[model samples]
Target: MALVIGVVSQKGGVGKSTLARLIACNYAASEWRVKIADMDLAQGTCTSWNRRRLQNEIEPKVAVEQFLNVDDAIKTGEQYDLVVFDGAPHSTRKTLDIADACDLLILPTGVSLDDLEPTIKLAHELKKHGIYPPKISIALTRAGNSDVELAEGMEYVRSSGYHLLDGVIHEKTAIRRASDEGKCATETSFKSINEKVDQLVQAIVNRADELGKK
Candidate 1:
């Protein structure tokens, strides 16, 4: 079975789809048969992004398909080396199902109580549903260049007994602009951002193996 990475968030504009596409883009570039299962059927952000990606002739194409059910999405993953799920921004049975089934569950959020609180609640809810913290990670996304805010966010996530990824996605115009061009922040001219994105990707890939060993 293909390794599944679920990118979930409880609120919109938290970079859920952006994070999913970043990972999927890098994986596809590395020759992994990657597919993004856009779980947000109503929005279809990932699906539409993929169309723009194709139109712009982005390298190492990745497939994006929309699905309403978690099981149906997993079945499609069977044909790929890795499947990245762009989950919806609201609570749903399908969201929990995806969290429980994924090799690694990623909760992307900004560094604030507004983002982390709901995300932590969702994480706790998933824990109650059988997905433990070891299989879940909190990714700091769309963060600004505030050391205090970032430190506080990291500490908050760790104190909640969840893994806080070291490589954070900063709130950069380059990140947003790259995505608009069907590219990832890692593909931009910003070397520091690229390194961070690469680090995050490596950690996630290692996490999949880490969870599998348990």
Candidate 2:
């Protein structure tokens, strides 16, 4: 059976789509049959990115599917080793439905207050609705030099009592270029960022392993 992971956020521009693409590409490169389900039917960000990925001839083996329904997404998950879901900002119901069906849920958010605050609420909501799994995690992205700034946000997240991955993806121009070229984060030659992404992938896989042990 395939491992299903959903990347979601209540607000846009939190890098949920980017995380989905990153996971799909890297997992596929690792020899897993990976597929991405673009649940954002309106934005179609992942869909378009997949097209660009094809144009760039990057990670050709990774498949991308644009899905409008939860049933179809569930079906797609059954066909691959890993399925990464990139959901729309407004599609909470659809996203949660998929979450309920996933083995893990990745809520990618920026370290800034604007992005992190609502995610805290969403986390509670997901738990309340029984859609969040023990494997659910919050990934911090687009981090910058604190000088006390970044640390403040981290403190806030910690104080709020939520699970956050140990790895953080620093802001880099290479990430933008990679997206523009439809390449994965690791393909951008950003070794540091790729290392962080690798840590994230390992963390998730380890979590899944732990879950199966129980």
Candidate 3:
């Protein structure tokens, strides 16, 4: 029973794939047997990222795979401690299918109205499919410490009947640089963003533990 986490959303450029890869790379580096299944065959962004990771020698410790379907992706589920599914944008059917198969669904949205709306709609859609997990959360990415706009976005999410991660990752050049190097934030020398991502991982682990007791 691996703890499967699906990173999903209805919109693109919301950092879904980036979050998935980051989590997978960091968790694996920490000695957790981790696997990442990229379900977005059209873009193959995660898959390509992993490829670059291999070529650049940044993915030495992570096991990443690309799959076109849920069943194929779950084939090695029992072998790993965790499985992360990086989903395609705007694919409700595929997203729901992955939701049904995961222990947790992590919807990553930025601090903006455009990003928030689709996230709320996505939550409702998952509920409608009856595939809602015991733990479904919203994560705030690309945040800024002094930005009043980020605060407004948090207020909006609080009003939407959903839970947001207590730790918000600020928009930093380090994130993009680390990604390009095929390294996770945790593996980079930067501490600010890495610490926040670690907190996000801990929160998910805590929620998954709580769900297991139910």
Candidate 4:
């Protein structure tokens, strides 16, 4: 069976799809057959992005498909090594289903209270629904260059009693441009930005591996 990872958020513009694409691309680059199940039917963000990626003929091709339900995605994903669920921006009954199905669930948020509060709340909700705390992680995304603010955000996530991924996805014009061109954060032209994204990806991989052993 393919290892399933879910990227979900309480609201939009929190980098949920970005993280999904990042994981899918990285795993595909490593020669793993990966598929991104774009569950956000309204936006279809990853679906359109994959179109651009194919048009650009990017290497390490990643498959992306829109699925109305998680079970179908999991069934299709059995042929691949990994399946990444890019869930809807807001929580619904389906959110718990995704949490139940994933080996690792990532919640991406900004540094502000606006983002942090909802992200943490969603984690608590999942826990209430019987999701294991260790399988749920918080990733800081679309963050600015303020070290103090970043530190506070990290502390906030830790204080909430969830695992906080080690690196941040710093907001950069290059990353946005790369996304516009159907590239992920790590595929930007700037090597420094790529390194930062890679750090977070590594942390994600390590966390998933650690949990798989238990």
> Candidate 3: lDDT over CA atoms?
0.80
Candidate 3 C-alpha lDDT tens digits along 1-214: 6778889998998888888987787668768898898888888877777777888886546677878788888878789888999999878888988998888788999888788898988898788778653467888887766669888988988888777767676778888888777776555668866886788777766766666721
RMSD of each: 1.5, 2.0, 2.1, 1.1
Please, what is the whole-model Cα lDDT of each candidate in the order they appear? 0.87, 0.79, 0.80, 0.92
Q: For candidate 4, write residues 155-197 as lDDT tens digits.
A: 9999999999998898899988988889999999999989989
Off by over 4 Å in 4: none
CA lDDT for candidate 4: 0.92
Ranking according to TM-score, highest score first: 4, 1, 2, 3
Clashing pairs for model 1 are none
On a 0 to 100 scale, what is the lDDT of residue 177 in model 2? 89
Mark the 10 consecutive residues where model 3 has the least summed lDDT: 205-214
Off by over 4 Å in 2: none
Q: Is candidate 3 or candidate 4 better by lDDT?
A: 4
Top candidate (lDDT): 4
Instruction: Please give me the total number of clashing residue pairs in predicted model 4.
Output: 0
Displacement of the residue 36 alpha carbon in candidate 3, Å: 0.4
Q: List candidate 3 segments past 4 Å from native.
A: none
How do the residues 15-72 of candidate 1 rate in per-residue lDDT, one tens digit apiece? Answer: 9999999889988888999999998988998888888889999897999999878898
How close is every model to the real structure, measured as TM-score?
Answer: 0.95, 0.91, 0.91, 0.98
Model 4: colliding residue pairs: none
In candidate 4, residue 58 scores what lDDT?
A: 87
